[model samples]
Target: MSRFYEIDPTPENYWRAIILFGRNTASYKFALAKALLELHGNGKSQVKLEELAVPYAKHLAQHIKQQPKQITSKRSSFLEQITAYNQGQLDHDGLIQQTTRLGFNNVIDAFHKVHGNDVGSRFFIDQRRSHGGIELTDNLNHLLEQLSAEDLAGEVEARWRLVEEAWANNLSRQLMLVEYEEHDQQLIGIHSQRRISLTSARPALNGYQKGRCFYCYREISILYGSDTPADVDHFFPHKLKRCDDGKPIDGVANLVLACTDCNRGAQGKFDQIPALPLLERLHTRNEYLISSHHPLRETLIAQTGASREKRQDYLQDAYNCATVFTGSWQKWQPRAEGVAVF
Candidate 1:
């Protein structure tokens, strides 16, 4: 069994729990929390319900704008509301009114539930006053102090690292990969408005891998209209361990360039763990991504954990889980010899 199965439910781990196991709506709550934290700074400041709504709405708008065209109806409605407000179709009063009608108050309510009622409730203290809206405990404020303002992405990555470390130190009966897949799906859904295509990050990935298939490490083409154009493969097969909502892990950490043959020929390997070599290659490729200063680096860190030691532990845990489910693990080899491991 992987050590990740035995993570203790500590306060710090509760933060990780919220990231990896919180409800889908928790994404909005997290964004709002971060925005509030930024606004609150190092003092014990209390923001009014109306004051919080402005930044929360702005944050949600930014999130919606970054998404692909296919979003939930609720998000689409909110998007429309924000668009009208931005276009001056709605004034400040109108915007606030629309926000109430659009169900943002529900998001706020959900945020409090996650922080107060969830298993990781120890991480936060929520005081709902009859008049002053909500008050955050000093404990929550102190915890936020340790986080960086690099962005919500960075804050999530940092918390994930903490969870990874906890798992590495203890072995439990439950698998962390299951929770990870759940979390990954929610994240993909939140950002699903944008699809990742071959043309999106191919240039950077091709250069980083020196034009080789990330898995097979076989020389591949990057040019358009080539007989053997590169295929974008999910490092973690999407078909296996698919989410209950039918969403697959389409995040940057799971995607990589592959040769046509390597991709199509690898059928029946869906959701199964790749050989140790592929796992090692994925780790190295992620390092390359980080070194290149690619935005995907943040995704990789969030999904795989931060630090080199934590990354290794995460892969091992994933491998252990896959092996248990499939009964055996298969190693992927290069079709031809002398293919370098990039």
Candidate 2:
């Protein structure tokens, strides 16, 4: 069993063999194993029959060859069960063996057999969750290193950089068009008809405040620029005709963090970020920051601030604008009906 699943993770030099040549030829496993044996380990131990990488008896012509669709998920019984064992979730393998998810068993086994025990191979396994339960915990760090040398990373980073450079040239002109809240120490200078190319800003939105979502606690994705990452939000409603322009706050002052849902969403952006009572104060202080809900005004000031008076109100308002939706350190939970997915 160890022979089928185990791979030596030590001896970093062995990894380069697979990392480099595997992209061009079907001889990837042989080339990698030979490199390991020759440069680092015993040369005499090379895989003799190309048994390591070749899943079928036939030799593959290329590295990126479309795997033959001829092989179906149906397996020859015990072959399927053994796969369950290596996946680490050996516990669930038995339970799922006869279920509709059976194809999962065969696929997992074949996957583990080919990929060995390395973390990168887990992504190819039949089931999304393997018998061996832990995935990203064990997978990400290991695989990232392997992929570091892969061609794809270089291409994505390079393409993204060009787009970014083009955007920077347009930033100053764009900033001039925005409208901000006319208040002391506002978080961001707001904008009007401020449009950013989401494609170029994709990296910043996800990478903007770090690897996390600015408001919600989801991990930012590289692809998120297509629509998932955070966005610029208005501190005050632009619709009430209170503000002269439509752009949300622009600079660090009026700007706070927000997820895509809250920005495009119909809920009052500023009101949702601030605690309910404090929102009332913002509404009263500036018509631009007006809180339409009169009934909730006093209550917001009472619970969210340090004291019932003016001094505490200033502190709370400042805190609300600066750190309100930005950090995950303090979690926010909106009360909801009995059942909810988020």
Q: State every prediction's TM-score relative to the real structure.
A: 0.43, 0.25
Please, what's the RMSD in Å of model 2?
21.6
Model 1 agreement with the true structure over 1-342: per-residue lDDT tens digits: 111112444333344334433444224554565555556663545655565567666665554454322122335565577777766787877766666556354555555333246453443333435544455555455455543333233444333332332233221322222122223222221222432221224433443444567766666665556665666667666543532222224655566777776777655233455777778877776665544212344556666778978877866666565566556546555554225634
Q: What number of clashing residue pairs does each candidate have, in the order they appear?
A: 6, 31
lDDT by residue (tens digit), candidate 2, 1-342: 111113443222223212221221122232222222222222222232222222211121121132221122333343333343334445543423432233233332332232233333332222244333212222323444433222223222222332222233333243222122334212121234443222223232222222233434444343433344445444433332222232223322233334555445544244434454434433333321112111112223332332346634543444444453354234233222122111
C-alpha lDDT (0 to 100) for residue 105 of candidate 1: 45
After superposing candidate 2, which stretches have Cα over 4 Å from the reference? Answer: 1-199, 220-248, 251-257, 260-342
- Least well predicted 10-residue stretch by lDDT in candidate 2: 288-297
The deviation in Å at residue 136 for candidate 2 is 20
Question: Which ten contiguous residues of candidate 1 have the minimum total lDDT?
Answer: 171-180
TM-score of 1: 0.43
What local lDDT does model 2 show for residue 222?
36
lDDT of 1 at 12: 36
